[model samples]
Target: MCSSCVMLFNEKNGSILPEYTDLPTLQKGEILVKNKYTTLCGSDLHTFTGRRKEPSPIVLGHEIVGEILELAQNEPFYDLNGNILKAGDLITWTIFAATESDEFVKDKMPQKSASLFKYGHVQFTEKEKFNGGLGTHCVLKRGTGILKVPLSVDEKFAPIINCAGATAMAAHRLIDEIENKNVLILGAGVLGLIASAIAKQKKAATVTILDIDDTRLENSKSFGADNVYNSLNPIEELTAITSKFYKKGFDIVIDMSGSVEAIKTGLKFSATGAQHIWIGAVTPTENIEINPEVMIRKLLSIKGMHNYNYEDFINAVNFFEDHFTDYPFGTFIEKEFPLQETEKAFQYAIKHKPYRVLITI
Candidate 1:
């Protein structure tokens, strides 16, 4: 089969070079997928701009949706839902693949297992050049968690299910309960918006969102945000708004911005016993100081979620399938570029900083 892919040879140079490679033969327990669409994510942008470091000669897109092209012969492959996988079934898999015996799997963080293989983050080799989503084909490793996407789910909406959508699910999973809770989301990007919607669906008393971008704040309202505030406002003004609107502060605080300043501000508005989940700090950043006394008195609990586990991915798919029509998910994609223009797509994503940009493969 013919295959083409864009590779990032050097993050310092910030170039995505196109290359054509011969498709590799399927190995035991492996599955091949023809990537249909991939969305450029914030992490992808970081790698492109050299803010995050990844090995050279890697294919970098990961928010992907594709159809199964083939499965290793002489064995039956089943998805997370126990359905048999076959060619042409639209699907999305966990960003990571880890064997059952992986040490982290026993710790309940399969995504962090010792033998983990992340889809878009690995360096390409002759044996597995199509492992990332930027390519025409992706080889789903043996331990990857696969799920079938409902045909009703729009192609564009399915791509983010594995990344932004799944991470949002994982964030909520960490928080545990949302009913009647005043939920605050920090950031108005794709993850923030999805978290807001999920909180609303869980019957959150109010969904408040904060972002520097007014346009994104305006968009959050459509995604179930009850209060939208520009974080650029003076701290005193923001404190006043939070005091008046949420007298006891927010019951659950979620940070999707990864801004140290934002996390510090969110701490100010968290109520006693509030649960705080941080999902956006994938890259290293300057540490923020915290007052141990204040945290102790408030009985606050803070948790951080990186990628996501298999269960989170399944919940993400189910959430989108059940509510795809409930929100304007399709509108989240700001632009689309063909696979050949993958470089241009990254450039547009960097320049515009839209919620998402898609590469139609």
Candidate 2:
């Protein structure tokens, strides 16, 4: 077996470095996957740059896709349709391993357990240590939600499914009538793009997007955003657009911008009974000032979601397969790098801020 390499914390400072290590042995019901593609997510970059706090000396990539190397003594592994999983099938699993049936687990928010364990976030441990996708192999915890990559979907679409795509699915779970709604997406990143596509597919009346990057906003139109705005000109631009776009305001507001300012701005333009989803804001930061009267007066339904459930993962996989022709999901992977170039890959990702930068193993 090849040596397992992990992105570890440099003891001197908080900077990240890769260290070669031994592979983790799988426990019962667990599976050891040979990671093929590891996408560097915004959260990963944030953790690296000290923008987000994590139990350090951790392997950081969580948007994972890979081949199965060893499956524990269990036969229930299968695709979304019950097709049994095999050794070579490419698969992606949720970032969390939330299987305990205790009340904390049954409360419907598994990602918030007191003893919660997540990939790409926790500190390295001796017992089942290789948990992140940056390593050569990862032992999927017993309760991790798994799904097979459809043959029709290109491999490039695999990594982001677990993070951006699945989160989009989970966020839109309450929206039943997208066609009748005016959708607004903040931040034209991966999550924003995927949400735009999903809203468009549901036949939203109008889709508007906000971002500072002209290129991203321009490209968003093809991804289902009918109108795009530049947040750089904060006050004037937002005021003018909000007044003309929808006199009654937007029916749905999806916030994928990590900035708290967006949330503050979003609350102002939410229509009555609108569903406002908070999917970004992963790191702990200062609280934004907002008027409680706004939410109460608007009668808005506000929801915050982190990782997705098993069903959403399946939906994301199916969406990529079905919508590949209309939206180039693969274009999100702007560049690919070998495992040894992991550091350089992340540097490239931060510097360019491309849709996504993949570290292909």
lDDT of 2 by residue, 258-280 (tens): 67777776777787878888888
What lDDT tens digits, residue by residue, belong to model 1 across residues 190-231?
A: 999999999999999889999999988998999999888897
- What is the TM-score of each predicted model, taking all chains together? 0.96, 0.92
Instruction: Quote the lDDT for 221 in model 2.
Output: 84
| Regions more than 4 Å wrong, model 1 | 1-9, 244-247
Candidate 2 residue 305 C-alpha distance from true site, Å: 1.4
Best by lDDT: 1
Misplaced by over 4 Å in model 2 are 1-3, 11-16, 74-76, 79-81, 234-247
Pairs that collide in candidate 2 are none
